[model samples]
Target: MSQPQGFDQRDDQSDRALRPKRLADFTGQVPVTRNLSLAIQAARQRKEQLDHVLLSGPPGLGKTTLAHIMAAEMGAEIRETAGPLIEKPGDLAGILSSLKQGAVLFIDEIHSLKRVVEEYLYSAMEDFRITIQLGEGATTQALTLTLPPFTLVGATTREGQLSAPFRSRFGIRERLDLYSPDELGRILARSATLLGVAADAPGLATIARRSRGTARYANNHLRRIRDLAQVSYGNRIDVAVANEGLAMLGVDAAGLTELDRRILGCLATHRRAVGLKTVAVTVGEDEATIEDIYEPFLIQSGYLVKTPTGRLLTVKAYQHLGLTPPEADENQQRLF
Candidate 1:
């Protein structure tokens, strides 16, 4: 199974091994990586710890991977955890206190942090210290613990949910975008070589086109195809083998999953803009999953459009289903 930014732990080992160890090895995300490279270089030139960084983007786009790459580039040990895991102030404090000087503390899904815990980070990020109350009522006393100078790297898909003060503290912030088809192809090629899978360009391209612009999906898709190839294609994955695997998995030529097609099918039936909740109910998916995971690619690939009202299937979506679409006029185009 694919790790989410994979906080689930079961997929950690392979996830880390497949991840790019250096900034140079990381693919796509040119603009973010460029600025980060300069920032890391400048910090290294000064012989100082890099500033706190916040990486915002959809899941599986390599925000956590970039954080790890940064730690490696800085030659620092990285401690990793998710925001919800660090519940109380003491939980946050303990992680901060245990860090060595110049360590990188990576917090994934940082937008999920409780307000109390987030507030505790302000001082730790700024003055490198945290203050905690040490007793009950009459005996209560505030005690401050100084933390080692370190970098805080946080990754989240919901950047808008972050508080203003919390967002302002990060010296470096970057949003990772979806990868292009060619970029995913390159990533899949590298992964195939690493896994000792014999795959041609067409095989990789076939899988890449179905990866929905996410590296995590690309890797996952490649591995599945490799397994299928081993069973029937003499361990060689060609375009035909790739397509057969994808067909079995229910991933279409356009990379739409069963859920994605369900969302589109809902739009087709609605024949008009529909709210996310409606689609979620129709497709048996959570509203957030529809908005975050499935919708972006549908919109990007021109199969769907988000109107002021809701989501509408584009002409391309209907055509993909082998059905004729209603006449789309200039008015509908403007709504897009």
Candidate 2:
């Protein structure tokens, strides 16, 4: 396949290069990090390399950062690639064969790899060998190439879609959970210091609460707020300036963006629970994006609930929208 432009390709290599040097710098996922640290230390003690690792999580949750950190700590050369980029088996073979000893091959979105390419990876990951067949005749022979003892770090957002056999190959498999408000606040403050932005306590807290507990969202909000502050007022970002910036961006104090409001509005106004399809259509977002990006935060914040019937707006959501809950809802709540 021809190379796709603007997919996993960005000009922010400098920012990417300085994400985190060690596992300690890569924040969040404490349990996974502790387990992985133990595994790495044990491998080092045994004078053997760590086994293949699989990180499953939503996007922007620091899978790539952790991969780089692992390579840095292991003192190995890192080769980065994505699943879609490796179209053919030869593409993977060439990359694997060129690796130096103990190199780290980080493949992001590993679930997208073609079946043929994935099959080749299974053998390479297990036995450090690749079999290439030559000629079409009955006398055709299979040539086996020995690969260096390297690590394959696969990151995927959809772990369920991965084939069972493929999923079983990784020695370490962990999921990155969504960050809490406190964790996101710390991340925002850290990134703010690095970006040379003076954010007060209230400003940081506001951004953190409004960031929906995602470090990427928090960082992006800070960037926008900083730009707004620089343009409208002085470069200093205080609570007032932050609130003004967020208001102009249509993000409320509760971290409910305009789209989020629309979703709740539909559910509240309809006076009944609605299916994901209906919610997506009303909000003008794809169902998958709603589930992956927006719904999780809303549900976690007590603004929405996934019922057996469908998506229901909670009393808090109704209050946020300046609406009152129905008597039936109140009675049902009391009975429950």
Predicted model with the maximum TM-score: 1
**Alpha-carbon RMSD, candidate 1:** 2.6
For model 2 the local lDDT of residue 20 reads 67
The alpha-carbon RMSD values of the candidates against the true structure, listed in the order shown, are: 2.6, 4.0
Give the per-residue lDDT of model 2 (tens digit) for 180-217. 87887777777778778788878888888887766666
- lDDT of candidate model 1 versus the reference: 0.86
Could you say which candidate leads in lDDT?
1
TM-score of each: 0.94, 0.87
In model 2, where do residues sit more than 4 Å from their true spots? 1-18, 135-140, 326-336
